[model samples]
Target: MTYCLALKMNEGMVFASDSRTNAGVDQISSFKKMRTYNNGTDRVIVTLTSGNLSITQSVVNLIEQRANDPDVPNVWNAKSLFDVATLFGECLREVRKETAAYLDQTKVDMGVNFIVGGQVAGEPQRLFLIYSEGNFIEATEETPFFQIGETKYGKPVLDRFMQPETTLVNAIKCALVSLDSTVRSNISVGLPIDLVSVKPNQFEFNSQYHITEDDAYFSHISTSWREGLTTLFDGLPAPDGFESNTQAAVTESAQPLGTPVAQTSTQHSQTLTPASVNASVAPVQPSSTQTEAESSSQDNQSSAPTTSLMHAAQNNQPAQRSPAVAANQQNTK
Candidate 1:
């Protein structure tokens, strides 16, 4: 498992990924997931990869090996970011084809994913998510971010805060928080995190950071975000009718067995209280006319109303009577 995310904003593009990968619990390792290709003058491309490590590594190695070849189009020589994404998808498919010879498709997961983004000389900055089938989709205004690999834990933060108009610095903060949220919840996505930022048409990275466990700013983000959420939750108002619910519970518990409970504002019907909410019965001193079994049956009848009353009070509805209990009450009436 892994976590990688990219944000495309009006100011530029931001990319981030965790370093941890594992074959199993016993075989944990760290590897760089972000790769860069740039010729300072003409173009710049950044890729964050996830899935089978060997497949991603092979695809990246292939791109680098063929980048300088004069006869073919490559990431370095591609005219636009779209062309670069296409070339990357092609290379990824080629790598999978090579591995498919011996590996069983059903038994082994050969799927891979990439977040490819940056600018070429004539085009604006663009971001894409390249899939295992050599297909890709670009980020747009409504969906200004993309995430791959263990995406659920970190996605709420990004969905709430990410926007096309967000500034570069704020986007970086959002990305780091998103990663931190994931790292705390998932063991597979650990740090040190690699981050890169690029401005539109700059054709080179504007900022790069590698955040480790002890990095002061990253530590502050983790602590502050946790504390802030705690404070916010503590300060939130309680739901309506909470006080009534609490009072009803207290009243229900205080009543003696066979005591008739008064209808509260929240309860829609009358009820008989039992000795305890758990429906337990204290040992009964059998009457002269009653046997031990008869006393036990009477205890069960008395406790049967406890469940229906508690549920009705919570839902502010009428208590539903069981058929046997209803018939017994009718006979008494």
Candidate 2:
């Protein structure tokens, strides 16, 4: 198993992945999970993989082979990010076809996931998560990031902080914090992380850093974030109606052989109205341009029929008018 994360932000894009693969406790190994293909400043494609190491490696090999082959359509010749994604999906499928039989014979599952992020010339930076089946989904404003293996432990931090308009620096910080949380929770993920950042329309990545165990900045962030979390947890209010009892039970649970009492809510419940629920949920504001367009449409809808009627009456001849109006018009004429 591995962990790969990629973020698409307004400022740029950030990509990070770990480099640990293991078949068993005794067969642990390390391999670079991040790969980049740059085509003479015209485009740059970065790929991170997680899951069955053999399958992923095979997929990578296929991509590289086709990319360099001149005779075949590959990342270099792909016209758009969507084209690149399609190429990747095709490669993944080919690898599966070639290796599935052998892997089945060996009783190993052919599970692989890829997070691909980059830009082609004249296109905005995009991110995609490609599955083993060769299909993918793009990241968008509503969902501005993607993660591959061991994602659950790190997802909460991302859900709390990531946004399409987040700064690149802040996004990187969040990614690191997320990776730290995952590393602490799972042994399959480890240090020597690969990080890359690309500015929109730049055609090349702006920053690439390899964070090892001895990296000073990473160490500082990891420690500070952990301390901050502990402090924040400590500062939260205990549940009402059981504050003292809950604290006592928590303390007892920490003891070696104590039977701690389970804390249960004793407070009266209040029925929630739609307005209350709406107030609790965050409000999403529409763009100013959309609001303006809506207002203009309303104005046009209100005035269009009246203007049409007046123009029609002015253009009409005397006999074209209705009988009641024609009689009054003849008397005026």
Shift in Å, residue 71, candidate 2:
2.8
Cα error, candidate 2, residue 56 (Å)? 1.0
Local accuracy of candidate 2 as per-residue lDDT tens digits, 21-46 = 87778877789999998855789889
RMSD of each: 10.8, 27.2
Give Cα distance to truth, residue 265, candidate 2, Å. Answer: 20
TM-score of 1: 0.75
Backbone clash numbers for all candidates listed? 0, 0
Output the lDDT of residue 31, model 1. 95
What is the C-alpha local distance difference test score of each model? 0.85, 0.83
Q: Per-candidate TM vs. native?
A: 0.75, 0.72
Q: Per-residue lDDT of 219-291 in model 1, one digit per residue for the tens?
A: 9998999999988887775543233323333343343344233323334543433324324322344466678
